[model samples]
Each structure stands twice: as structure tokens, then as C-alpha cells.
Target: MTSEAEGRFHIVDVSSITSGSQRATLRTDDGVRIEAVYEPYTRGVTDTAVVLAHGFTGSADRPSVRRAAKALAEHAAVVTFSFRGHGRSGGRSTVGDREVLDLAAAVRWARERGHARVVTVGFSMGGSIVLRHAALERDTGGHTDAVAAISAPARWYYRGTPSMRRVHWVITHPMGRLVGRYGLGTRIDNRDWDPVPLSPVEAVPMIAPTPLLIVHGDRDPYFPVDHPRMLAAAGECELWLERGMGHAENAVGEELLGRLGDWLTRR
Candidate 1:
């Protein structure tokens, strides 16, 4: 909320879209450019806003992100932004480390726009960032009304599952980063965390008394049920476990998205 520069449209296709939404580029306090879109909630709703953070390799324009945003917009204003390095933003990704700054910037934007209450909802890597961001924001005396973290990992360096191992390879291997940069449009950092950042479970304790919802799927290949259990225990919040849900945004259906929007509205 302290400092940000509004940016104009850089892509014609996105600019030509006919939705009743506002698009702008946001500058993070650390100086990263974040591509974002804001969709005001329907008139009769209360003054609450939801900020969405997408998973790794996903952007604000992704169909899944837009779908979730549209669903949430039925109840509250929605702000969806691509984390630096993932979309048209300028910066290499440290995975979830500096991404917290991206979420913080978006949350501040929501507050600045006159939303009395702000709820952060994140998916996958984004989910972890939301948990950490809310905790970090509160530690600095900032306000975050509520948070919903879905399909997030409790701890880092987990490779118990084969899919996760492959993802690790994609993120850590040289050729993988090449493919990520070119093929997937994702730029990942090749450096290690010198001073380890707070794990998702570690960050949960600090978000106390602020509403928190932990949602995970039993069938997620990236993370087992234990991840959500660990977060639920640490945060002492409600956990919604879907029976056959897979992972992140892909696994999220429209019905669930609406329910999550309702959940945030009620909070």
C-alpha cells in the first residue's frame, strides 16, 4: 500500500477483451513489475475484496485463473495478478520466496481501492505464498482480513511423490529451466535459499485469530494429505479435504470456486 505505479496495457489481445474489468501493471515495493487485473464485485455485495495468487507457471490471463476470478466476483471484488517471473512481469522467480512481495502488492491495492475487508486466496505455490504473506503482513502491523490456502505444501524440499520429484527436476535442472523459460514461459532462479524462509506450517501460527481456511485434495500427486493436515494443525483452522481432487487450479471446479467465494463473503 505504501508505493506503486499504475501501468497501462501492454498486450492488445488482453486490452481488447470485453469484460467489465480493469487491467493494470503493479510495481512491487521491491521494484518488480506485476501484471494484474481487477474486477469489481456486483453492486449489492458488501465491501469485501478477494485477491488471488496463481500457481507456478500460471498467469493472470490463464483460463483457470480467470475462471476462479469470475466465480469469486459474484460475491466480492476480485484482484488476480501474475507473480513476477511467471507472466509479463519483470523478475526471476525464487519460487515462493520473493513472491510474497507480489501478493503483498496486490493486497495493498485492494485496501487502497477502499475495500474494508480483504481476503487472500492462493493456489499451489501461490497458496504457500498467501500463508506466508499474511503472516508477514501481520508481523509488520498490516491488515489481512482472511486467507484461503488451497493445495499448498506445508514444508519445502519435499519429493516424496514422483510428480513432485519431476517438478523438482523441472525447477532445479538446467535443461528444465531452459524448457521452463521457453516452453512454459516460466523463469526460475538457480540459486538456493541462503537463509531458509518460513515454511508454510511455520508461517501459519502467526496468522492467528485472522480467518484462515486450508483446503487440499486427498488425491493430489504433488502433495499428500499430510501437507494439509500439518497446516491445519499449525494454523488451527478449518480444513476442507476433497475426495478426488488432483492439484492446484486445475483440480478446482467452478462449483468449489463459488463456495470459496461464499466462504470469504461470510467471513
Candidate 2:
């Protein structure tokens, strides 16, 4: 499945790379096409694979997502994918709800490639999706070894920070959705989360027995330290609050990402 528009080429097939990595077009059960890239371990073939989920309005090719994927690839096989509505993928973003299906598809792809251990690592909106996905227990392999969420919100509809308020505005206003669709490459749903999806705090407890690492920054404006604290308490998991970290993928530098990769490998 290949297509071209205005001289640019698009390969929509599940293509294999010479280096053992696989780049594929994965379709979710809900009928969304996801752009996914899998990079096998550069060091050695390890049983563990880290599945990375990006933040809101972000694609797998974003510099921060790529940096984290590259860093984690040193420790284990890495799978990174763009959530629907974010990149070349189809469908509108249900914010964090339907995105879980996207993560589930990526996890299935990792398992299909024979990775025995799948560790999900997510940032911001991705972080919330990972939590809910783990709770839903929909991994194609029947189990996920570990989960790591960075700068995730515990509850929803929080507007304490200016950034979050702006985000809310972007999600609510028609002009904002227009800008999101064109400028950010994000096709977002304008409706509220009807029937209400499980909150991250509510989802955390169900991820127990499966190791969880909740990482946040004390200075994060998007979500205060209390968010991580609430998550830690619910899941009874380990928490790491960085001193001056800002938020999500951009705030997580190489050193911290290396440590996170190390943590995933150790488990």
C-alpha cells in the first residue's frame, strides 16, 4: 500500500528494515491507521521491548519522542507510534480515551515480533493512555511486564496551570480545534468524554502486581507534584520527582531517559 501526493511518497505497508527493525502501518480495531516504527536493540537482542507513546499533538517523529526512543533502544528493542489524529494516522483524537486502542495496537506489534517482555512508557496524554491500557488488560500477548508514566495527570479536567487552561481552550473552542487540526496536525473531538473514561488515579490500582513507575517533576506546571503523589498512593508504586524538571518528554533529558531505560531493563 503506497501512495503519493504532490511528489511526496507514503509507504503504508508493514515494511521490514535491514537492521531488524520494522516500520509498519498498523490498524487499530476501531479502524484507525497508526504510523509505527520499531527499532530492535542495537546492543543485543533482549527479551524486553519499550513501547513509547507520545504526548498531545505530538507524533512519533517529534524530536523528543525520537530521542527517548533512541535512548531506550540502547537497552532494549523500541517501538514508537503516533496516536491517531496526531500524525499520518487516521481518525479524530478522543483525547486520551480511544488512544488506548492505539497503544494496544503498538503493544501487539511488539509481541508479534517475539519480544517476550513489553514495557509501556508514556508521556502526558500518552502517559494517561498507558495507564488505562494496562488496566484494560488488552495486551495481545496477554500480559505486560512493566509500565512507566511520566508527567501524567491523576485526575481529569484540571485547570490549575495556565498551560492546562490553554489546552482546555484548545479542546473546547471550534477555532482552537481548527488550529489543532491544521496547525498541530491533531484532529480532536469537540465533545466531552461521555460515559466518562477511567481516570489515571482510578486506573493505577488495577495496574498493581504489574510494576509501575510514576515519574513527575516538582516544578511541573501542567501537573503539580500532587498528581504523581496521588497516583503513587493508589498504585503503591515507586515515584521519582525531579528537582527542576518542567513537563513530559521535553523535560526528560538524556540522562533521565537513560535512567528510565535502565529501570525498564532491570525489571
Candidate 3:
């Protein structure tokens, strides 16, 4: 599991009890500092590691993210990290564009921890990141064995829903950015994508042979069912349309988490 990237990880906490949970700081390839936590399997022994990526404004220490990680730990070890600009991480959020580097750093860290297989599970903005990371980092040491994207957008600049429209305002307006910073505790970069990075739909096809799962809620307000449908069609992957689910980490429940854990285990 060791690689050159392993040198970039600096463990800040080493108190490994039965949970094998520890805190560390990771340096992305681009040099952004990221906060991460590693939690070992809760029940049984397994070599697989699940790298959990949280949605926009969410961080490694978020309650929802922590719960999801704990639930998934029942199947295998889980690695959760705060994307740059969120939580205690350094750098501004480029939305989903450069976030791939953050995920790549986390994946590399998971591998360095001696995991035989690494599975990436993302929610919302994180979902988009995992798809793009799985595609773009395939050749790099950050490759993921499997991927699951939940409540992700198929395309960029999508304002189809009111929630998404508000999101656009939050990303594009100064006042919205102020609210995001003070109210949401999320610092967003003011620069627009000079050349828009790969969209989730476009990235999905490139993740072939690597198992992919598209999970979306039928009643999601940010992205409609068509988003997941587009991803499934492009990648020809497994699609799970949760009936009553709403969106992202907030909507995820124990049952769905268990199912996701099972999917990661079987993969």
C-alpha cells in the first residue's frame, strides 16, 4: 500500500484503540492541507477501505458525515476527509473542479494505510468529485476500486430546480458568498472555471471496468431523477433510486447506509 504519496501524510493523532480511529493531516498534490480521520471496521476484519466524501459545505467533522462513516465502518474501514476550504482544511473551494486533488490525496492515504481495496462514496458535490477522481486519477496512484455517487449532478451549471438555482446564486454572488462564509462556514472561491472541468456525466464513461453505483433520491430538490439516469446510462452502472430519500448526507438513513455498506463490501 505504500507509495511516494505516503510521505505527505502526517499523523496528528496516534491513539489507536479498538476502533483504530485516528486523526491526520494530508497534503494534496497541489499542496493544500486537508484534515482526515480514519476509522477501522467496527465488527469484523476486512482489507477494503471506504473513502467517504462529503457534500458541499460538509466536512470531516460534520455530524452527518461522521454518522455515515460510522455506519459504513461496519463493512470495512472508512476514511473521511474535509475537502479544501471546508472545516479545518486550507485553500478555497473551487466547487468540484480542483477537488479531485483532495480526493486523490485521501485515496492515496487510504492505500498507504494498508487497505487492499479502496472504494469511494460521495454525496452531492462530493459525488461529482468521486466520479471525476475515479476517471482522472485512474493512472495515478490514487485509483479507486469502486465508486458510489449519491445526489450528484449530471452536468455543470444546472439550475433546473429551485434549490439548485439558489445554489448557483450562492456560488456566483458576493452576498451569497458572504452568507456562505458567515452562515454556512464555507469559503468559496470567487474565480469561475476558466475551462470548466469534466462534468459527472462526462466523467462516468471514463470509469469503465471499475464498478460504479449511482444513488439518487426520487424527491431530491437539488438534482432530479434525470441526473442519476444520465449517469447510469453513460457508465452502464448500477442505479439505486431510493423511494423516500431526499438528498445527500442529510437524507441518508441507517437502512440506506447499511445497503451502501453491503454494496461496497460485495464490490
Candidate 4:
């Protein structure tokens, strides 16, 4: 949060352009322009690519997402982009609904760049969107080799969220109202989408056969450690529950690169 630009964006120049990294604009169907970072030669000679999807209110420039991208780049081409209404991507946010579409576009974009094996990594709400996107794509005949959900709130909000008053957490966060006011998203739309039905619990079933890795911080205040377990149980997914870790603590430290590197390499 060191820098908050007009677009709720920030960037960490971790690598040089000479590193063969390129930044470009990815146009979405809704006309919002998403900022994308492409790091080729990650896998050296693999036809695979990894897409890193940051959580709610997160952008590609966020240190966590950037680091994940760089880490995975060691295994394959890595692409990280911002969700609409977040960062430089178009219009206001649509919660996770339209964000699913954004992931789809990014995947296709990566495929065109020579990625025959596509892997998606989503954190928090980004995980939710990844599940929904992969599900929708499957229903439509598109294919994804693997999809991972990390520390996602895979249950419905507005139900029994005594913790953090999860429903109100979404409804009252100032930024939430701000996005609604700007027509970037809608408050009522959340009511229409049940977390349980739309959550990893529901989405995990469809991802079976395709590889999945569910990572979670055992001490996560927002999502239970068992969350990842449940997500994995639904499909043939591997589970990684970090002891004493909470939420997205995976974004930092040596473990970050090692864990993500291993995951992308497996894909």
C-alpha cells in the first residue's frame, strides 16, 4: 500500500526490461483496458504459461502478485493482469462476475503467445473468480490444464459470517461503496450470488482430472484452514496448508518462490 495511484494501482520494478519482460494493454470485452505483464522464457522451452490472478482489490503491480509471477516465470511464461475497476483495467469492478471474463481473456491471450499448457493461480477472491471462470469455460467447451485457489472464501456471504461480519465487510467497506457509486460493481449483485453455490465447494467438482492445488494459511482469520482441504476433497487436487500462516502470507519470503515455482513447474 505504499503507493495508491488514481487507479488504485502500484508497481514494483523487480526486473529490468532487458530481463525480457514486457508490459502491454489487454483489452477486455467490456472495453476496459487491463494492464498485463509477460515474462517469456520462464520454462526455457516449454509451451506452457502461467496466469497469476490477484485477489479482490489487488492489481498486477502488487508485490505478492508480482513475486508470484516472477516465481512462476522460472517454470514457464507468466502473465499477470489486473481485474477490471482494479488497477489500470477498465471501468469499476464487477466484484468477481466480470473478473471471470478477464481471466478468460488473459488465458486466451497467453495461449496465442505459444502457451499450450495453461495454468491459473488465484488468491482470495481471485481464486473464486478462477473457479467460476474455469467452470464457465468448461460449460462452453474451453479447456484449462489446471487451476489453483489459495485462501479463498468459498462459502456464501450474508449468511452466518459472524467473523468480520463478512456480509457487511463486503457491503460497508468504503471502497465497496465507492465502486458501486461509480458503477464499477453492484451491491445487490452480491446478494444474488451465494458464496456456497458459487464458491470453491461448488467449483471444485468441475475441475477434477485437471490438476488443482489448494493453498491456505492454517491461521487465516478470513478463511478456515479446512477451506483448502474442502476445496481439494471436491476434486483430485493437492492441498498445501501452511502451519501458522494466515490468509495470503505466502506472498512474501523464500517459501513464496519455492512453492509457486514447484506448482507452475508441475503444470
RMSD of 1: 3.5
Taking every candidate in turn, the Cα RMSD to the unseen true structure, in Å, is 3.5, 4.3, 3.1, 6.3
Q: List TM-scores for all candidates, in order.
A: 0.92, 0.92, 0.95, 0.79
Query: Per-residue alpha-carbon lDDT of model 1 for 94-170, expressed as tens digits?
Result: 89999998888788778777788889999999999999998889844235788999999999999999988888987
Q: Is candidate 1 or candidate 4 better by TM-score?
A: 1
Q: Name the TM-score of candidate 3.
A: 0.95
lDDT of 2 by residue, 129-230 (tens): 899988887434534688999999999999999999989988999999998998888999877888899999999989878889999988898999999999
TM-score of 4: 0.79
Task: Give the whole-model CA lDDT for all candidates, comma-separated.
Answer: 0.86, 0.85, 0.91, 0.68
Error of 2 at 235 (Å): 1.9
Q: Which of candidates 1 and 2 reaches a greater TM-score? A: 1
Off by over 4 Å in 2: 1-20, 138-142
**Best of the two (2, 3) by TM-score:** 3
| Model 4 C-alpha lDDT per residue in residues 1-267, reported as the tens digit of each score | 122232222333334532767666666666667777777865468788888888766787776777777667777788888887677666656567677778877887777667778888888878888787777676442356788777776664523336546535555577656554454333323334433345667877877667777778777777776567767777777888777776662543557557766776676
Worst 10 residues of 4 by lDDT: 1-10
For candidate 3, write residues 145-170 as lDDT tens digits.
Answer: 99999999999999988998898888
Give me candidate 1's TM-score against the actual structure: 0.92
Model 3, residue 208: displacement in angstroms? Answer: 0.8
Q: Over 4 Å off in model 4, which ranges?
A: 1-18, 139-142, 158-167, 170-176, 179-197, 249-252
